[model samples]
Each structure stands twice: as structure tokens, then as C-alpha cells.
Target chain A: MSQFAPPVVKIEGITKVFGQGETAVHALRGVSLEIEQGEFVAIMGASGSGKTTLMNILGCLDIPTEGDYWIRNLNVADLDEEQLSVVRSQLIGFVFQSFNLIPRTSAAQNVELPLAYQGVSLSERRKRALAALESVGLGDRGRHEPQELSGGQQQRVAIARALVTNPAMVLADEPTGALDTQSTKEILELLHKINAMGSTVIVITHEEEVARAARRMIRLRDGQVVEDTKWVA
Target chain B: MGGLGLREVWRFAARGITANRMRSSLTVLGVLIGVSSVIVLTAVGNGSALAVKQGIEKLGTNSILVMSSGGAGRFSRSSNSNAKGLTIADAKALNDPATAPDVKMAAPILNASGTCTYGNLSSTPQNITGTWASYFEASNSPIDKGYYWSNDDVVAGRPVVIIGTTVATDLFGTDSPLNEVIRCKGQSVTVVGVMKSKGSTGGFQDADSIVIAPITFVQRSMSGYGSLSQIQVEATNASTTTAAMDEVTTIMSAQHKIKAGANADYRVLNQASILASSTTSSHTLTVLLAAIAAISLLVGGIGITNIMLVSVTERTREIGIRKAIGAPKSAILTQFLIEAMLLSLMGGISGVALGVGISHFTVLGVKPVVSLTSVLLAFIVSALVGLIFGGWPANRAASLRPIEALRYE
Candidate 1:
């Protein structure tokens, strides 16, 4: 545990396999990485190269078959499902590629969903959700249903939801994948602005433009990291 | 989220209910069919039984009847017409002070199935009884058209008779039947009076029927002199009936002079005991009906379980989303549990209402229905059905693995 320089994500020798015996798929093979707090990193890989697998492990939605992972200095790989849920809620925010908003719910309601599990009072949850929407610059549009909102506004509402719980980082899985060119740029700018505000950001995407927006990049092929690049300088 | 209380469960349940209103209505319909059958069948049985019981009670539940044991129904074990029966001697002996002065009254009845004719008004072979005027008092036969005979009419062995209301109305058209002559088996017997419509007494039709004349007159002029039907006795009240029966029995045993322990040559039956037993048998029948309907309830419960399991499958992604956002397994369990209870409670309430409605049709104009208990019972059983049948699927929903659920296609 280190103060003032908390390593937001740490993984060592993570490996994952699917199936058994003669028909095994080695989705991840001894992958290892680390990122300090407030760093914006992008993970780029082709289809079937296990990027989603690693993302799942990093987000605590899954545990590695053979590795240890620490998120914000807490050992997560050893935690059980219930404990992982706690970490998922309080530490990591997620914005899926599909937006994955519950159908027919308004943006503010979606944002407040996470805080409902946190046992926050309704008024407090409303306030925080509104503040998060304002942070993402969609405060006035909180009541619009996901279908009514444009792709960019929808992703931002999802972002506001991810941010409302004050997580250590936001995991955006191709957050701008389905958006138009302008909406993608606007979302990428929002992610940059969010990173500048001191929360770590990790993005998984196949788009070169999306990867190029990150300060650091790690590339994977055939379940192994083939390249790591730092564009910070 | 902090509290799992009834209100929150109800809220969740309301959303589920509104989400699929038609399915809810149909499910409730299944329960309604089940509960309503239980209610209507029970009410019909009870109502018919009440009608029978009221008809019997009019003769007075305290009235003790004796009939030739040639037997009546399945339980008619002791006596039949083939056996020697109670005679006018028995009634005369019972009228003795030593035998049954407590037998406030006793009617030695001799019945013949015979047609009686008056001018053009000819009647079917109805029940023609031979007894003294006190038979009306003991048997609760009231005179609506005319008066019964005096003891002089009975003792002088006059050919006078007190006719039942049915007999008078059929032959004499309800005018004063007294002093009119009715031809029975070619002999003219004077009808001294008309009896009130006794209705039915203990399964015996009192209307379209007959009453009258001394047993001596019946024995001499109608059937053989020694042959008599059974004797009926009226006790002062219910409490003394047993005592009165005891005395009558002791006297009859002496009169018939039986070998030790051969079961009395005569049989005594209590009307109250019969009424009470009918009610008991009816209760048993109701339970059997309910048990049969309970099979439907069981099927309904299973339906609830199966639907919930499908819901778990359909909402796997939602469960994942909730768990991904920090919902505990307990919360998931409660949500599914609430859904199941909502389904069953809705079914029960509707079932109760439908059951009550069915009872109206079954009651067929009768009031003070038999289905109130059935309604309450249906609710409790439906609630239990939820706990029993919904339990496995609710637990299944609650115990889902969030990690895998998130990956579910």
C-alpha cells in the first residue's frame, strides 16, 4: 500500500483458459501489466485475442485462473464473488460498448442505479447523479431516455453513471465504438478531461483513432502483448 | 436497497404485475377455477343438506320414530318388515302409566299404500295411516283445513278419520273435509278434519299423503287386526328423550320377552342423532372436495415455480447488471421471492372472489353461504403454495453466479 502514488491497477502473470482436455482455448497467456493512478492507457487487440478477458479480470467481474491482481492496493484476485461485487461498485466504473442502459429508464435514473446498491439516501443519490451528469456536461438532459438521447449523450450519461460512485477508475470498453465521428471525438475529449481530473482511465478498443487518443498504448496479438508504447513525451 | 420490507417487495411486485397484466389475469383464472369449485360445491352440498335438515327438524328433532326394521338404507341393519314389528299392543302398553307416562304421547301407526276416491277426484296410492288423534300431537301433524277427532270418535271405533292436508286438498279440494266420505278399498270412512301440510318429515312425504282413524279401526277394517306398523313417541324435551326411550325400551323388552342379549326385537332411532350425523358426513364431504381442489392449487404453485425459473433465465443479464453494480445475493433473492409471492397472492385474492361468486350460482337463491371459510382457506393455501412451489425457483434466481451471468449471451 503506497500513499500519494497509489498504483490503481496491478497484474502479475495472469492467464485464463476455456474448456478442458483436448479442446482448450488459451484466451490469455501469462499477461502482466501495471498502471499508476491518473494514467490513461489504451488496450488494442484484434478479435479473439483476449482483450475482453483481461478487461473482465481488471474490472473484477472475473478472477484470473492463475494470477494475482491488485486494484488500488487491494488484492482482488483472491476475493470471492460478493467481495468482487463490492470492489466493482465502490472502486471501478464501467461503460460498455453497447451502452447497456436498462431499457426505458431515463439517463438520471440509470446514473442513480449504482448508488441504489450503495444504500445512499434517495435525495443524496439524486444530488450526486445530477452532479455527475453536470460533470459529464449532460446535467439538463438527465431525464431523457437512452433512446431519446443521441449516441454521444447516451455514452456520456453512462459515463456520469460510472463516475457517480467516485470510483478509482473508469473502464470504458469501446465507449465510443458505436458513435459517429463527432460523438467519438467529443467522448474521447471527455475521457481526456476525466483523466486530467485525477481518475485513472483504461480503454479497450480495436480502432486506431481511439487508441491514439490515449497517453500510453499496449498492443496484443494471439493472447500475448506484442508492443507497449508511451506517447507522453 | 437498505431495507427489504413488505412495502418494497410490494413495489417490486406491482411493477411485475403491471408488466404482464394479461398473464397475471390468466394465472389468477386458474386459481379461480380451483377455489370456486371448492366454494360452490361445498355451498351446494351444505344448502341441500340444510333444506333436508330443516324439513326433518319440522317434525321435531326430539321426536323418536320407530319403523319396521325391514330396513331403510344401507345402515338399515336391525329390522325389516319380514321381522315381527311394533304393534298397537305396543302403543297401548306404552300409553300405560308404568311404561311411559313420560311418553307425553304415542301414536300406533298402521300404514297402507291404497287409493282413496271421492266422486271424480280419484287419487294415487298414497300413504294412509291409522292412528288416534294424539298422533297429530306426537308426530307434529297440524290441522290446516279442519279439526282432528275427539277420543269419543276413537273409542266408539267410529268410522271417522282425520285427513292430512294433502289428502284433503287432493280429494275434497280444501273445502271442509269434515263429514265428507272418502272411499278406501270400497269402504266409506268419514273424514272428520283436515291436517295442516306437515310437508316432509324425516324423508317421508307429508303432502300428497294421508292421516287418521284408530289403529283398531285400521286393524279390523283395513289390514289384519294383529299387524301394525311401528309406534312413534313424543317426549317433553330433548334432555328427557333418552330417559323416555329407556323406559319405552324396558317395557317393550318385557312385552316382547327376548332371550338374553339377542339385540332388542325393536329398534329405537333418534332424530337429533340423525341430524347431527348428517352434518358430520357433510363436513367430511366438504373436506374431500377441498382436497380435490387442492390438487389444482398444487398445479398452480408449480406453474408459479416454472414461470419464475423462466424469468430467471430471461433476466439473467439484468441480474448480472444488478450484481455488477454491487447488489448482494440476498437482494437478488428478495426480488425474485417478491415476484413469486406477488403472483400467488394475486391468484389467491382473485380465486377467493371468483369462488364467492360461484357459490351464488350454486346456492341458487339461498343465503348465509357456505363459502366464507373456503375463501379464507383458499388464501392461506395459496400463500403456502407460493412458499412451497416458488421456493426452489426463487432460490435458483438468488443463487445465480454474477460473474457467469455477466457473460451470459
Candidate 2:
């Protein structure tokens, strides 16, 4: 692929350090990567390999200690807190391992939260939220709260929330970590369907089965990338 | 899309509050109690103050009274009595415009307690006021029937009397006391007129339980004495009462042959002075109660602060989620502040209703006059309390980093 196409996400020599002095912990040491538009990528690592820190920086939730991060050709590393939040809302959607849907809020309302923060009118927000819920095949459960849904269905609602704003990319952190094998397979399949429909997706997982679902896989160890491979399907 | 609109933030706050119904209601209740007490106490205070003022006004705004004081009246009946006290001559001097220019009318009052009887009914000690006919108009007491004893009656020491309504009822019942003869103080006197019912003055004195006659009749026929009790002076107008009192003091000093620096045997009490003293005491009481009410409001503010801090800590995850979804710090701060303000505003409204209801329905010791100013003050103070108290917690919530808040568990 030509670099001139401008990858959706680009990072070079990014480092994240926590604390200072003798007790300093280097979470990400000189990490570099590029993700093209509409790409389905998986980052695999054990708990101490700093994959979560990389995910945090990529989602714009935290800034790197050093190095440049570009998302959609905008310098993410240099952006202010307010600018970072806009980038997070307009460019990246997050799916956590715990689903993270507000407990008492209905699935549709949860999906509408990002749009509401974006200052969308009430009617437009409701319409978009319902449409996103329908796309996740939970059209009949629009008013159902997270507690009332099954694990796999809650994950679907979260994915709907993630896609409600039509973000440039969706970042999933252990998306199926808390699910049973059947639900996990269903969630992975849903992600695959989303990817097939031209949405870029990044999955962070320690499980090989989850990583295998993506065409491009990067393995991390000791806060550094050790293997980068792409399968020729 | 750049920032959250105030409308959106408000809706979000409403949703958040409703999601935890108990907590919101409890917080609202705190503010309600504070505001209601403030309004109610102020109403009661205002009502009592008005009542006192009206009572003092009923005593006649243009009247001044001169009475014996400093134990001078104690030796009035003794043979070796030296204190001149208040005398008929003093009243006569005060009535002279050249001597006391502001004095419009002066009446010599010789008060005596007498028993009145007619047919088979009798009254307990009825007060006998002996004065000129002008005393009726000066004291704001008007005769309802017949006529007051005239100057001719005073000159002749006539056996005629003007009885109050209560005394009239006691002596004659349904019968007309117009010309009926009533026995008083073992002397027979014809009822020449009936004074109108002057219910009560200064809250305690029964104005209608009296018999009015000529000062000469009181001194000669009733008391069998030659001493005067007090002098009641009426100024030309309400504004001239102090001037009238001063002129009366000067004339009385010369009449009694007293030096300028010496304390006169009698004290001149003006209506304005009495009104001012009463008003000041009532105002002080109102201020004390208002202070207590303000303290209650302060306690309410503390309650708001306590709950808001807890809410900030409890909603850490929610704050993190909002931050993640592009809610700016200003948005989060506004969201929480609007929530606090709404709670207090609603509380203030309900408190006003509650206060007005209580004031109208219940029988407070005072009349409970609900002024618009008091209600507005209570409302504004409640909102200020919300803002001042909610600021700290909202700031804490806004300053939280998304990663740290999200990881707060």
C-alpha cells in the first residue's frame, strides 16, 4: 500500500511512561504502527505487554509521553484536551470488555449519548439511535435496559453505541473477554460483519482465536511489537 | 457539534436526577424546609409589627399626654403635699396658643374609679374620665348618642354623665339610658349621652368600660377632691405633636415656678415617641427571627454540598463515559450545576406555596402577613445557596481525568 493514501491511524516512535524517578514504569517503549482505512486489525498481548496503554493512546483517552500520533492526517499527540475529546467522539468509538453500557439507561438512550454530547437535536438523536439499534439486530429491544439484555445482546447494544455516531474507526478492548464461547463467537461474527461493510475495526485481545478473526495481526511483548503479519486470505 | 447546548445539558441533568429519585427528593426537601421557615417567620414578624403599629395609631396620632411621675402624685391628698404634680392650671396654660402655639386643645383629666348601678344591675369599677367636650374628638372617641357634657356642665358642676357602651349595657341593658338617672359613687347622675364603643387601646385597656363627665363633677361629686390626674393635649396636626409637647413643657415649667435645668414633676409623653419605641422593638424581634431563619438556610446549603459531593463520587463512571463521548469540562460542570439549581428552584417554589398555605390556614400567634419582598428574598437566597454549595463538587467532577475516572471502578 502506498503511504501517500494517508492511513486512518499512524503512530511512530510513541512511548508512554508512568510515574517518575526510580519507580518509573515504561508502559509503551518506542511503538510504531499504521492502520489503513477499512482495515480489520488485532493486537495481541499478555496483561503486562502494554497493549491496553497503546489502546488508551489510540482512543485519545490518554496522550503518549513521547512521539507522534496521527489520526486521519491530524496530529493526535499535539491536540489539546478539548480537541482530543472531539477526536474521540467524531473519529473513534470504544467497546470495552465489560460492555460499559449505563446500567439503568435504555439501549436506545445509551446509543444516543454520543450524539447528544455532539449537540444533535432530540428528534435526530432518537432517529439515529433507533437506526443504530436496528442495524445491530436489536430493533425490538430499543427500550430494554442493559440489565435486561443477555451478555451477547448487551455487547451488541454497546457496538451499536459505538457505531451510532458513524465514527471513523471502532476500537474494541477485550470485547468478548467476559462472554461464554457461544456469545464470544456471536460477537466476533458481528464485528466481522461490521468490518465487511467498510468500517475499520481494531480488536485488542490476548486470545489467539479472537486475534485470528482479523486479517492483520500484531503481537506485543514487553511493551514493544515483536511480530507483524498479514494473512493472505 | 462543537459544544453541548444548555438545553441538552439540562435534559441530561434531569434524567440523571430522576434516575435516583430518593436522593433528589431528599435534597429538595432540605431546601424546602429552609425556604419555608424563612418565609413563614418573616410573615409572622411582619404581621405582629403591623398589629402593634395599628394599635398605637388607634391611640390618636396627634395626641400628647402629661402625667405625674417620680412619686409626685403619691402625696396629692396629704395636707403637707408640696409637689404641684399635673394641675388644672397647667392644662389651662397649655390651651393658651400664645403660650403653647401648637396645642389645639387641652383637657384636664381627673380619673376616678366609681361603681354604677341602675334598676337591679351593677358594674364593677368603671373608670370615670372628667374632661372638656373636646376630649372626645382629641382622643378619637366619638359619642354615639345624645351629647357630651358641655362647658356649662363643667362651670355648674352638673350631675350629668356620658357612659361608654359597656357601662351603658350594664346600667340599662335594652332600655335607653338617654335621660335615665344612674347612681354612681353614691351620687345620682343623669345619662346625658352615650360614647361609642372604642373596643380596646394598646391591646389591654378596655376603652368602652368608662364613664365620662365634667372635670368639676369628677372632683366635687365623685372623688370629693380638688386634684387633677393628667392633662391630655391635642396638637393641631400629627406633625406638630413634638412641638406641642415642648411648648407644654415650657409653659408648665413657668406655671409650676420650676427652674430650667430641673426635672419637672410630670413627664410629657408624645404619640410619636411611643410609636417610634414600639416600632423599633417589633423590628428588632423580626430581625432576630430572620437571623434564625437564615441559619436554617445555611444548614440547608450544607446539606446540598454534602449530597453533591457524594453524587460526584458516585457518578464517576458516568462522568468518565461523558468525557469519553466528547463532553467538555464546561459541559460537565454546567450539567451538575444546573442539577443543583433545579433542585433549589423547585424547592423554593414549593416552599413558597407551603408557606403561604400555612400562613393562611393556621392560626399563628400573629396575623402572618406574607409580603412579596420576603418571598422573593427567600427564593433568591435558596438559589444562591445552591450555587455556592454546588460549586466545589462540580469543580471536582470536572477536573477528573477520563482515564482516571474510567479506572475508578
Candidate 3:
């Protein structure tokens, strides 16, 4: 962690257990990590290695069973569901393997959804959504629905949605998992472009090629972090 | 924009409905059928009640009829030659201002059924009344031609008759019945006047088929002389009909000479009181029919709830996506609730249109009367039903965890 810049995400011995006693499964076991502002990091793990659990924790979709999780100096572990939602809106953006665009809605509307939750004015939302789409190289396709777009284009729309709120961090789970090799490459390059634009980006993936595109990589095994490494790409 | 407004919520709800056209339409159809039935049934109830009121009015809003019921002091010689029931004496007593000050005119009615013949035509008259000349004035039966029996005709027991329009048509056809001679119940009577037509009065009695003659002539010819069945008394106005009824009762009781606590042999039927009581009962019936029809609304509400619950489950992933993108529970709740409201509102509006159209065509013997209060009440209630029935499913959708929902297939 750098001394000058506060970490966008800070974790300290966070643990998550799925159920109580006898049948209980520890999905995240006392894992700790810090990611600074504007860093591009990849989390690598095999199946059942708690990668998704950790990602869910970081995204504030679920509360940890133990320990502290701070985003932008606020203790997320201490926050309620409502406050967590606000924090998630203001600080984190999420992208999934399926793209997750509302099926019948246009690309611009998908991007504008987060702002709608924030209660933005209509014209302003339209402007920001269009700008976000333009930044993701889908400027002309804002009115196109998801089904009308290719897999790569859909992922790009999902990326635009993530960045639309100008969040502190973007969390992606197997974002390129459903894409062809060329689309996968394109998605990774977009993430690089996003990270370079000074927003923190974190990706969860099992593919080595996808992980290598990030400046740092962390691997999980048996619900515990087994390796953490830094690299220049 | 951090949260949804009313317009945005509505738009979102509309989109959700449009997305699943078949399901949404089926839910709306349920509510439509319910609301339309409510409107139509209530209208029918109201219409029938109004018809009954008008019939009573046509019967004469200020008229009261006193009839003997074979109790104490029966005076009619037709019932018992020795025993006394209602008679022409009692009718004259009721007509006297000193005995019944509220009574405008009291006409004694002696009933008979008779076959009347004019030339080759012969038909049974529905009403053969033995009454004085005052009967036409008291009963509001206008004279279309000739005249009623004069005091000379009654005193001499002359067989002169005043025929109603139906009797006139049956016996005289297009020819004038004035001064024509017709045989009634084998008694030859001259038709002195023709009573004007009093159209159908709906289930009470037909007034146009009557043949009225001098009470003396009717009593002597049709039954034992001096026998009478009823006295129809008209009050000065509608407001005093009850007072007029009480006055008639007191005079009759005195004429019968029954003790203070004993029941009188006669009964008085007051038109205003009957109208009021019938109105109350029919109002109750209308409400009952409306309540029964409201059950369909409840069933339709349940249909909306069921469909909404299924929709929430089907769109689990969509909910997850919305939640993950920072939608609060209130937003999700609002979305689903608005969709439910829209479903019922659409159904309600269309149902009202259809109901009004159906009522305008007039069903049954009465014209259906659609009241504005009922239409507005039905509409508002339908919207409330959406909110009420949609509550549980909307809460369920809002309560779903984003992570679990995202993972749902």
C-alpha cells in the first residue's frame, strides 16, 4: 500500500462462513488485502477457491462474517444494507460474465440505470449515459438493445455501465469468460484503458492470459490467499 | 439522479408490463370482468328500484286505500248480510270533513268481474267498479268522452257505465262508446263516458281495463244491495297522506264501534309510507348485489398477486442486476407495486367503459341506471386492491439478497 494515496479498498482478516455448525462451509477464511486508487489487479483461483466470495465481499453485495472492510475510509462491515447500497453506488461498479444488460433496454438506458438509482435528472442522465457509451467506443450504438449487439459490444456496454457513475473502483467477475479470444482481448484492453484513466479496476479470473494484463495478481486456494505478486506489463 | 421519481417508476412499470404482454393482459382481463360486473349489477338494482318508485307514484302519491279483512265488525253485506264490514256509510263518514279533516275525497269501491257486450263483440272487463261520480276525480282518471253517473243515476239505480280505454276499445272499437248501450254481467248499461288511458303501471295494477258504474246499480245487480269492498281516499297532498290514513282509520274504527285495544276490521294502505319502505328495501338489495359482485374484484386482486409473485421469481436475475447497480429496496418495491397498480388501473378504466356501454342498451324491463358515485368508487377500489394485493410480492422482491438473486437460474 502507498503512503500518499489512501486505498480505495482495504480488507483486514475478513472471513465469510456460509452456514452454522456441522454443515458450515468457510468460503473466505481470514483473508486480508489492500488495493490503492487507480491500480489494475487480477484475482486468480481454481474452482471452489473462494474467489467469488472475496469478490462479493469487495463489491459489498454481502457482509463479512468477521473483520473490517473499508472502502474510501468508511467501514463497510459496520454499515447497514441501505448504507452499503449507497457506498456501492458511490464507490464500486460491477461487471459480470453475462454482460447483464437489461434485455429489452437500449445500451444508453443500461448505462443510465445506476444514475437513475442516484436520482439524476432525465436530460442529465441521458447526457452522462451517452458520454459513457462514447468513451467505451459504443457512441453510435447507444440506442441498440443487447440482443442487437455482438458479445464484445455487449461487454463494452457493461463496461460503460460500470464507469458511468465515475466510481472509485470497478469489480469484474469472469467478464471475458463468455467471449471469443478476440473479444476477450478487446475487453482486457478496455480494462487497461479504464485503469489508465485513473479508476481502480479489479478482475476475478482463472485464465493466465487475462491475469497477465493486470499490474498485480493474487491467487486463492482452499478459501485462503496462497500467492500475491506484482508485475510490469 | 440517485433515486427513482414517480414518472420514472411508472415508466419502468409500463415497460415491465409491455415485456410480458400475454401475462399482463390475462391479469388485466380478470380485473376487467370483475369491475364490469359490479357496474352492470349495481345499475340494474338501481334501475329496478326507480321503476318501482315511479309505479307507486303513478298509483297516486297522495292516495290511501282502506279494505276490510273479515276481522271484528265486518260491514259488507256481500260477506255477511247480518255482519257489518266496510260500507258506503263508512265511505261517507270518512269523506265528512268533521270525521276525517285530512281526507280530500273518499269513494266507496264495490268490486265485480263482468262480460260486457256491444253488438257482436264480447270480452270480460278486468275491473267492474261500483263507485260514485267522485271516483274519477279522486283516482285521477280523466274523462275522454261523455260523463260519469250523476247523483240522479245513483239515486234511481240507473244502469249507466263509465268505461276505461281498454273496455271502450273491446266493446266499441273505433266507434264512439258515448251513449252506447252495452250489457255488463247480464245487466244492460248505457256507456255514458270513456275514461282516458292510464298506461301500464308495472306490477301494481292495470288501470286502463276498468268499467265503472253507479255503486247502487253495481251493488243491486252484481251482489246484495248496499255491499261495498273498499274505500279509496285521496289526501289533499302527498305530505298529508299519512294523516289522512290515520283519520280514515279512526273514523272507520268508530263506525265499527270496536273497543280501544281491539284490532279494526279494516286496513289502510298509505302510498308514501309504502314508497319509503320499498325504497329502503331496494337500497339494501342494491348494496347486497354490489357486495356479491365485489367478490370478483377480490378474486382478480388475487390473480394480480399470483402473477406478480411469479414475475418476481422469473426476473430474479434482473432484480439482482438492479440491486448490484445500487438500487435500494424501496426502489425495487416501488417498481413492482407500480406495475401492479398499472395492471388494475388499465382493467378498471376499460371495465367502466364497457359497463357504461352495456347499461346504455337497457337490460330487463327497467333501464339500467349508472350512478357516478358507484363508478368512481369502483375505480378507486380497484387501484387500492392493486396496492393491497401487490404488497406481499413487492416486499418479497425487495427483500431478496443481490448475491443470492444473481446466482438464481
Output per-candidate TM-scores for chain A, rounded to 2 decimals: 0.95, 0.96, 0.97
Alpha-carbon interface RMSD for all candidates, in angstroms:
2.5, 2.6, 2.0
Model 3: residues with Cα > 4 Å off, grouped in runs: A1-6, A19-23, B1-3, B71-83, B119-121, B143-156, B165-179, B192-201
Would candidate 1 be rated incorrect, acceptable, medium or high by CAPRI criteria? Answer: acceptable
Q: Could you give the interface RMSD of candidate 3 in angstroms?
A: 2.0
Writing each residue's lDDT as its tens digit, candidate 3 over A1-233 gives: 35687889899998999989899999999999999998899999998999999999899998889989999789886788888788877788999999999888889989988998988888898999999999989999998999999999999999999999999999999999999999999999999999999989999999999999999999999889999998887
Per-prediction DockQ? 0.45, 0.45, 0.65
RMSD of each: 4.0, 3.8, 2.7
lDDT on C-alpha atoms for all candidate structures: 0.76, 0.84, 0.87
Model 1, span A1-233: residue lDDT tens: 24677688988889999888889999899998988888899999999989999998888777778988888778885677667767888998988887777656678878887887777777888899999999999989988988999888888998888888988989999898899999999999999988888878999999999999899999988788889898872
- TM-score to true structure, per model: 0.87, 0.87, 0.93
Model 3, B271-373: lDDT tens digits are 8778989899889979998998799989999999998998898889999998999998888998999999999999899989988889897787668999998
Model 3 CAPRI quality: medium
- Clash pairs of candidate 2? none
Model 3 per-residue lDDT at A181: 98
- Candidate maximizing lDDT: 3
- Index of the highest-DockQ prediction: 3
For all candidates in order, state the fraction of native interface contacts they contain: 0.40, 0.52, 0.73
